[model samples]
Target: MAAAIGALTLRATRAGLYSRLTSGVQGVDATTYPVLSGLARVGPVTATKLAEAIGMDRTVATRYATRLQEAGLIDRRPDPADARATELVLTAEGERAVTALRGAMESFLAEEMATWPPGEAAAFAMRLEHLTESLVQGEAGRSC
Candidate 1:
């Protein structure tokens, strides 16, 4: 019963988070956020490498990159190291969006966690990180 309740709670929290994030973000889908985040983190990288790093198929990753580029959130340039390959970089606007979304998400989470002890929040974060690693490392989109 406790495990069932925990599962339900996790599902509900994820829904609530998407709702809140959607309200906060303008002209962006939650699906695109992670791609933008990757661009921000890794600077410029080839689409193939970015796709591998993000655990998505090359074709799907290319689609996501195209969408992000259409939204002016990312720029694709010819790789200096390999002129035939393209490198993805976050534009200034994408950087702003990333920062804004990060802050909004943090604020939302902090609000939700206000009643919980700091240690509990830390533990929760650690557990989520572990789960994410398991998901990514085991198989793409398996644990999620």
Candidate 2:
């Protein structure tokens, strides 16, 4: 019962926050933030590698990369290891944007959960993490 209620609340709050944040940032969408942050963390990387890393389809990941490129948040450079492939890198502007976005999201989550005691948040996180892993594993099992 607790897990169910927590899941519902988390989903609703996430939707609300995404709507609010997207409205504030022109030309930025859900995937944009993750892709930019991923690039920032991983340095330059191929779209194929990034797609795998982020668990998105190649086409979907490509679209995100294209959108980021269009917004000047990311740059596509020729891969030195593979002449035919391109590596995605975050621009300075993208770095700034992603850093700000991370801070905002963290702050928002902290505020929303502030009333909850510390152990409650950690327990919620652990359960959610397990749920995510199970779901992914189930998909992988069926695909095989």
Candidate 3:
């Protein structure tokens, strides 16, 4: 199971896959996609917090946040909770990029599963979701 998971992770994270996924989205590549997608999931957050959530280095997150900000895909605004620190928020363009990325990924997966048996893909998706939930829960338990 570990080997299979590792192989899948490698294949899914390859540069080619990222290029394909981000084809239509400008200013987004493998290095920056995680930050963009992470922001979409967690909403406005400090770069440090976003980095922690996405398993990226704080400096890397801050740097990419700046790049994304320059691209007009994200905005850095004063944090409501902390006056000294800023939170990263996705702009309208950023939201659109996320949507496009998701659509592309869905299309890619559909193509990959084209040869699968009628219900097999759906079954696999369910199992994958369950496995992800279980892994997340287990990680939480360990952290506590």
Candidate 4:
């Protein structure tokens, strides 16, 4: 399982995969994928918080947030709780880009699984999702 997960991670992290996923989606690339996808999952958050959430450097997060802002894919707004701090939120365009990315990923996975029996693919997907959820929950618990 560990080897399989590692292989999947390696494959998923390849620039070619990201390039394919972000194709036709302007201003998005492997560098900005974590920022955009992190925002999609966690909603509005400060760059520092986003960095923490995504396990990236704060400077990198801030830089990518700036790039995304310039591309008009994300917005930087004053945090409601703090007048001095700002939060990054996806624009409508960013949402569309994320949707496209997700669709592409799903299509890619479907294509990869095309050779497998449909039931086996479905079961694997279900188990994978469950495992992911459980791991996330365990991490959340450990963080507390």
CA lDDT scores, all candidates in order: 0.77, 0.79, 0.90, 0.89
Per-residue CA lDDT of model 1 for 1-144, tens digit only, reads 668547755966767665566555554565666677777777789988887777677887888889988988788889888878999998888888778878887887889999997699989889878976875678745658
lDDT score for candidate 2 against the true structure? 0.79
> Against the hidden reference, what TM-scores do the models get?
0.76, 0.80, 0.78, 0.76
* Per-model RMSD to reference: 3.9, 2.9, 3.0, 3.4
Screening candidate 3 with a backbone cut-off below 3 angstroms (N, C-alpha, C), the clashing residue pairs are none
Off by over 4 Å in 3: 1-6, 11-13, 115-119, 129-144
Query: Model 4: per-residue lDDT, tens digit, 1-144?
Result: 898777767856577777877777998988899899999999998999999998789999999999999998999999888988899999999999899889898988889988998599879878999998888789879978
Please give the ranking of all candidate structures by lDDT, highest first, separated by commas. Answer: 3, 4, 2, 1
Q: Which numbered prediction scores highest in lDDT against the true structure?
A: 3
**Runs with alpha carbons beyond 4 Å of true place in candidate 1:** 1-16, 140-144
lDDT of 3: 0.90
Residues forming the 10-long window of minimal summed lDDT in candidate 2? 18-27
Candidate 2 per-residue C-alpha lDDT over 1-144 given as tens digits, one digit per residue, 9 for 90 to 100: 777757766967667766666555655676576677677777789998988877888888889999988998888999888798998988887877777777787888899899998789989889989987887889889977
- lDDT for model 1, please: 0.77
Between 1 and 4, whose lDDT is larger? 4
